[model samples]
Each structure stands twice: as C-alpha cells, then as structure tokens.
Target: MTPRISALLAGLLVLTACSAGSTPAPSPTSSPAASPTAVQPASGPAITISGMTFTSPSAVAPGATITVTNSDSVEHSVTADTGNAFDVEVDGKGTATFTAPTQPGTYPYHCTYHPSMHGQLIVG
Candidate 1:
C-alpha cells in the first residue's frame, strides 16, 4: 500500500482498538437506588455522617427528632442557613440530636468548619 494509505489504516485500527477497550458511560435514569444507611421518615429519625456526607434522605417531616451521628475523625456541624432555626454539632465519633423546624420549608444546612459539606433539609 502507499504511504498515505498505510497511515490511514493504522489510524483506523488505533481508533477501533481504543473504542473497543473503553467502557460506555452509565445511562441517565429516573431515580437512583438509596444507600444502605439512608434513613426514612418516622417519629424520630436519625442520620449518620461519614466522610463528610449526610447519609439520609433530604426530606423529612416537621417536629421530628433528627439525630446526627458523626463517625468522622474531624468535628462536623449541621447548621441551618435559615435564621438559625436548627443547629447541631457532633464531635468526632460522637452523636447529637436536634428538633426539626415546625414550619414547612426547605432549610439549607452546612458544616461550619468545612463549607464544602452541605445538604438541604426539606420540611413538609
């Protein structure tokens, strides 16, 4: 084959090999499966924090005893961004509880120490 044809065939073979070896990305779905430790609504619901993650559903009812257990090596807090309605802190490997807001609204919370750690508490 000519020099140009040989180069084109080599490029095609490389592209084919790359695509065959690559993994296809996961498809978008309507909903994702809940984690094993995700908590459900009840009289007194509890959530665990590990690796700076709030391991629970984002929504909960009002007037519930929302417990927060911190299993990390560093201290973390869940302080409400709305008027300081509910703020709770748990030391390393410690646990704390706070009452949910009586009003029906979304309360955005974050860790005071680490601003990157945040989640919303939807009270309805």
Candidate 2:
C-alpha cells in the first residue's frame, strides 16, 4: 500500500511539472509599442486687404498682420478715424503690409484718393 501511494504522488507531481513546462511564454511579437501622438502649435490668423476694398477678409483679426495690396492703377492710403493709420502709395499691381493693433476696437478707414471707397475693420 505505501508503494502504491508513493507511485500516485510521483505521477501527479510529474504531470503538474509537464503541464507547467509545456505552457508557452508570452512572445515579443504579441506586444506592440505605444502609438505615437501628433502635436500642433497655436498660431495667429492672417488678413489680406487688397483691391479698392478689403479682400480675402473684410474684418481684421486682433494682433494679426494686415497686408494691403494695391491692384488698382491709382495710389491708395489707409487712414483710420481713431488716428491709427498707414499710407500705402503703390503703383498698379503693387503690395504693402501693415501690422494691426493688438487693442480691440472698431476702426473706420478709407482710401484718400477715393473718399467714397470706404471700409471698416472690427478687431477683437
């Protein structure tokens, strides 16, 4: 009876050991690297003031650079009622650039050559 019991215990231990060894270890291929992330930087908007009137955008963005292009044959100037003004005396197909004020306000401006050619820029 002792010999039979010892034999059964040995068989159980051997089976357990075999099962543990047979189980496969996790493979490196099964795991993957963490996904990469994309980051974008914050930037200010742009405004293009052209033609007999403001082109591309009629309104001006605060703290943005306002670029004025004179496509007409006559010379034009940007004069604001609040004393914030810029002169753009360019020949036909010429271009000029000016920086808009950071302060938020309403500015009414017009071309000195043609008073009727008026426009308004609202900056916030």
Candidate 3:
C-alpha cells in the first residue's frame, strides 16, 4: 500500500479505538436515593437521646412518629412537658418510638433519668 494510504488507515484505526474505549455518560436518575427526613424503626436512621447530649432530628413534623434510640449505657425516659406524647424507658442500646402531637406547637421533653438531657419538638 502507498505510504499516504497506510498513514490514513492507521490514523482512522487509532480514532476508532479511542472512541470505542470511551465511557458513556451517566444519566440524571443514576444518582443515589434521597435520604429520609426522620429516622425509621429498623432500616432508617435514628435519633440518639442519651446522657446530656441529644442527637438526630431535634424537631419533627406534627403527627410524625420519631424514634429515639438510647445508645448510652443506662436507661432513659422521654417525657413531654404537656400530656404523654410518649413515655417509655429504654435500656442501654434500646429504642423508643413516639408520635408527635397532631396540633402544631412546641413541645419540650426531657429524660426522666437525666434532668439536664432536654430537647424540643416543634410540630407544624
């Protein structure tokens, strides 16, 4: 083959190989799922209420069930200042579940064991 024709063929082959090895662009839907607003019972995230530190979503929507897990090494109680939104004593590494009030208002809660451990739940 002529030198010119051979050079052209080599260039074409190199271009084809480069294009074939290129990765396809990702689609918009390929991204990870959006995280939940509040933690779930089993598979979902958890709010830690122990000691004097209160973790996770400090406030949640009204009528929403919040799961409070005690990761500390002692028992803890969740009591609302108003009526009993939910009062349960969870052992160490245990969890308690309670639903927020149907009305939208600010509810202050604290741990019976630890008076200093306090948090507020704002339902709207």
Candidate 4:
C-alpha cells in the first residue's frame, strides 16, 4: 500500500479498536465526610465534635444533662478546663452526657484527646 494509504488505514484501525467494547463514563459522586451527626442548635445543651472541632451551645439549664456527640472516626472528650465541674467522653460516631454545674457562669472546656479542641458552656 502507498505511504498515505497505509497511514490512513492505521488510523482507522486505532479508532475502531477504541470504540469497540467501550463503556460510558461514570457520574460524579458526593463524599459523606460526616454521617448521621446529631448537632443541635446553639441555644440547646448539645456538644458536637466534627473534624476535631467542638461545637457547643450558648447556655444550658443549671444541673441539666448535657449531650456530647462525636462524629469523627476517633473518640473525644469534653473536660472542664478549670475544675471538676463536668467531664464526658464520646466514642466515634457515638454520644455521651454530663451534668452542667448549677452555678450560673461560663465553664470553659477542652477535649482530652485533642487539646486544640476547646469551647465553653454557660449554665443559667
């Protein structure tokens, strides 16, 4: 075959091979970084841990049972920064609880596992 004709035939063969048994492209998918997270509003006495972060409510009822939720892949804790007012440990994708101090004031807290995670709760 001629040089030009040979080149054309090789290109046609490659195109035919590429089209044979070809499958459609897959669609885009979303990533579920956190699943079934129980995050309450800021006004409520709920604490949520996501991406090693602590999301705490503004204030809670005095001596109320505060809920602590963990959505990360590891365990976490909400411990009082000053005194033994409250301490709660939550497992991965789990929940725990602690009692709020009856004194009407801001109680700072931090995560025992992650020192960078910190927050505060007001009991009034």
Which candidate has the highest TM-score of all?
4
Worst 10 residues of 4 by lDDT: 26-35
**Residue-wise lDDT of candidate 2 within 60-117, one digit each (tens)?**
6676776666767667776675575444544556666666667777777777777777
In terms of lDDT, the best-performing candidate is 4
> lDDT per residue, candidate 4, 1-124, as tens digits?
8999999999999999999979977445633434356465444478889999988887888998888889998999999999899988899999888889989999999999898989999888
Clashing pairs in 3: none
lDDT of 1 by residue, 5-111 (tens): 99999999999998997887766652344446656644457778898887765677888788888999899999987686888889999989999888988888888
Candidate 1, which segments miss by more than 4 Å at Cα? 1-43
Better of 1 and 4 by TM-score: 4
Q: How close is candidate 1 to the true structure, as a TM-score?
A: 0.61
RMSD of each: 10.6, 14.6, 6.1, 8.4
Tens digits of per-residue lDDT for model 3, 31-59: 34454454553643346865556775645
TM-score of each: 0.61, 0.51, 0.58, 0.63
Candidate 3 lDDT for residue 15: 99
lDDT of 2 at 82: 58
**Which residues of candidate 4, in runs, are more than 4 Å off?**
1-44
Off by over 4 Å in 2: 1-51, 56-58
Q: List the residue pairs that clash in candidate 1.
A: none
